[model samples]
Target: MTRGLTPSVHAIWQAMGLVPPPGPLGARHDFTIEDTDLILRLAPDGQAATLEGTLGALTPDPHEATAQLRKLLRLGLGLAGFNRAALVLPDVNGADAAGAAALMALADRRPDQPPLRVTAQARIAPGDPRAAVAALEDILQWRSFARDVIPASAEPATAAAHPASPATPPDSGADFVIFQP
Candidate 1:
């Protein structure tokens, strides 16, 4: 709960009970939680950091992809009360792009392989190591919910074949009512 002072990524890692990677400033470190891959990049000044991870791949169907993207956008905007993490669409070149543009790029590049990956990012503020840990949890929660929204495979039959299966509820644990369309 400290404020006003910048903390090094090493300090944050220690606060989270993690071993700090041996690296200089602006280095990137990778970590995995429950099979989900996450990357943390320390700022040049070592005062701030950005934690990013892929939530899931977008469905190949354009219509479904668009819908999924819109839902993520809404969630990233804090409409679902999840504001700690920001969802983004990164192009194959690793440049940040809008959801629609990224989808189009993915379609042009490799329709067979889902190139459009929805990523979640959270900025670790200076002096708040706990916030960094919270950000990681938030991103992981978003990943779980996003996987349910965006199918892992492009085949529609896969979803149709299991239409009877109930969707996995999000693990937010909050008592907010969820609306289904």
Candidate 2:
């Protein structure tokens, strides 16, 4: 409904090897899933999947483009007859090494299904904890809706429960507890 966005995502799904590549009407080029009049081009300025309108190489502002992408995906829920779906935020383009590795691990180990993946890394040093938290929150909200609305599958928490190595004990200091997700 939003700028013919659903099929665009489908195009991306195809491009990612999550779904088979589209026929003559679709093909991969540059970084986007291309079709006539529309494109699900990977966002170049920031994160990926920042869907935008293209006209002779002109692109909308980054924030606006991101909003449009969200709108388009929401439209898919009703039109695609999918009430619930898992989102897998691929650890592609945006994420750093740790975040990317974690997501890749999740994808590799989890069942094959549509789960949104956000590549934001929270715990990685030099990373913004807030951004990581925001990404985590987004994943939770979507998952709640999906469980209530649609039948789907997901990967188990790969990094959530794993224990980190013990920090070096301070000399003559009391024991401290470390928490992990």
Best by lDDT: 1
Per-residue lDDT of candidate 1, residues 127-177 (tens digit):
676777777777878777766676433232122244554465558565667
lDDT string for model 2 (48-156, tens) is 2322221111012233323433543564454334322233333467665544544444445442332232311111111222332232333334434433333223232
lDDT of 1 at 9: 50
- TM-score of model 2 vs. true structure: 0.20
Worst 10 residues of 1 by lDDT: 152-161
Candidate 1's C-alpha runs over 4 A off are 1-26, 44-46, 78-82, 91-102, 106-114, 151-181
Best by TM-score: 1
Q: Ten consecutive residues with minimal summed lDDT in candidate 2? A: 51-60
